[model samples]
Target: MPAVLGIEVKLDPKWSIVSTPLFEAYWFTDGLNSGRRDELYSVDVGLRYSFASNLSLTNTVLYEGRTSNVAIRHYRDLRIGPRLDFAF
Candidate 1:
């Protein structure tokens, strides 16, 4: 079996500040029997700066998590970075 679910919310499109949340899950045939299920959840809140019509910059911080069978090990990660996009 396979399953995935997620949602993103933009606090405001016109504003420079925005927040997005995401979630996901995975289930295999052996999930119940072998406990091999996996889950991922994350949130990214950022600011958008537009230099021109097609050039922009996004700076964000992300908090994420990964959960699985103990044998597979579980961990959490945090990230922060800037994303630049240019369209011409």
Candidate 2:
């Protein structure tokens, strides 16, 4: 059986600031695979600033981690990026 759970909250919409939290897990139900499990956790935070009606800049930061008995290795990662939107 597999299950996923998460939560998200937006502090403000005018400034475009948001916070999201999530968790996911999977379990093997079969006899042989019983008790075997995998899990993932992640959080995403983002913000946007409008320079003008037609132009805006946005940034996002993501943090994630994964662990599983089925995989040889477990890993965690952090990613940050910026985006620009414009209309002509």
Candidate 3:
């Protein structure tokens, strides 16, 4: 990791984070010449609210791609998730 002297500013009234950054990549090798085939970055974003008691839902989308040291190359992957919850 590389670090330097830097500063930033934050100006917001209401802020919330529903998703976290997660990265996954794979490498292929055949005796020599290693190459990356599958690379993916996933995150979830949603809000939670109480219906009448203990109940909630979640929704998220994932992005998958194939990348290299030179170029991101080509990527075609899309995913979505929608769920509901109920209490008795």
Candidate 4:
């Protein structure tokens, strides 16, 4: 099963904050890892500024991690960047 939670809050007319969190589970049914389960978690949070109705910029922070019964599958990562979005 996979699940997600998201929220957005407007801070005045041109600025906003947004976040999305997610979780997923994976089951291995065959091979050497049979009957093993892995869990994944991730989230993205951003501050967005709108220049116009069709254009916006967002600075975001992202984190992703995974855990499994197998030690080799455990890992985590963090990322930060700016994203530009436009619609026509």
Candidate 5:
């Protein structure tokens, strides 16, 4: 069980920051809370970069379960490489 919270702040006309609580709950689709498979709904933060009207990129960071944190199975901390998109 988890409680969620959030806030919005406007720094300028072209910039702003929004925050919200994130959590993950794993259960089974076989039945009511079967507790079989696990899923992640990690907490994350992202930055928006606006290089032009037609081009922009969003950078995000997140906290994920570590490999050492797993007691019953193997795991690793969530990580992202990089993302880039071009518009023409």
Candidate 6:
């Protein structure tokens, strides 16, 4: 099963904030990993500024982590980046 929550808030007209949080579960049924279950969690948050209706920039941070019944399958990561969007 997977679940997600997303939100966006407009501050005035040119700036906004966006966030999404997600959770997912995976089960493996046929392999050496049979009857194994893993849970993944992640979230992304961004601050966006619009220069025009067709152009925008966003700075974002993301974090992800996973837990598994198998010890070698657990991991965590953090990422930050900028995104430019244009519609032409």
Write down the TM-score of every candidate: 0.67, 0.58, 0.40, 0.82, 0.45, 0.83
Candidate ranking under lDDT, highest first, comes to 4, 6, 2, 1, 5, 3
Structural RMSD, model 5: 5.6
Candidate 6 RMSD to the correct structure: 2.0
Q: Which stretches of candidate 2 lie over 4 Å from their true place?
A: 1-13, 30-35, 49-58, 71-73, 83-88
Cα RMSD of predicted structure 2? 5.5
lDDT of candidates 1 onward, in order: 0.71, 0.74, 0.50, 0.96, 0.52, 0.95
Q: After superposition, how far is residue 10 of candidate 6 from its true place, in Å?
A: 0.5
Residue 57 CA error for candidate 4 (Å)? 1.6
Write down the lDDT that model 2 would get. Answer: 0.74
Q: Write the per-residue lDDT of candidate 3 for residues 1-88, one digit (tens) a residue.
A: 1122222222232222245456666566664436645555554454434444556554656555555553655565767876575887
Please give, for residues 13-76, the per-residue lDDT of candidate 2 as tens digits: 4356655677888787889778778888888787877677688676889898989996754789
Clashing pairs in 5: 67-75
Candidate 6 structure quality by residue, lDDT tens digits, 21-81: 9999999999888999999999999999999989999899999999999999999999999
Q: What is the lDDT of residue 82 in candidate 1?
A: 95
Which residue pairs show backbone clashes in model 2? Answer: none
Q: Give the runs in model 6 whose Cα sits over 4 Å from its true position.
A: 52-55, 86-88
Error of 3 at 63 (Å): 3.8
Q: For residue 2, what is the lDDT in candidate 6?
A: 97
lDDT of candidate 4 over 1-88, digit per residue (tens): 8999988899999999989899999999999889889999999999999999999999999999999998989999999999999999
Residue 86 lDDT, candidate 5, scale 0-100:
68
Q: Which candidate is the best by TM-score?
A: 6
User: Which 10-residue span in candidate 3 carries the lowest summed lDDT?
Assistant: 1-10
Question: Which pairs of residues collide in model 3?
Answer: none
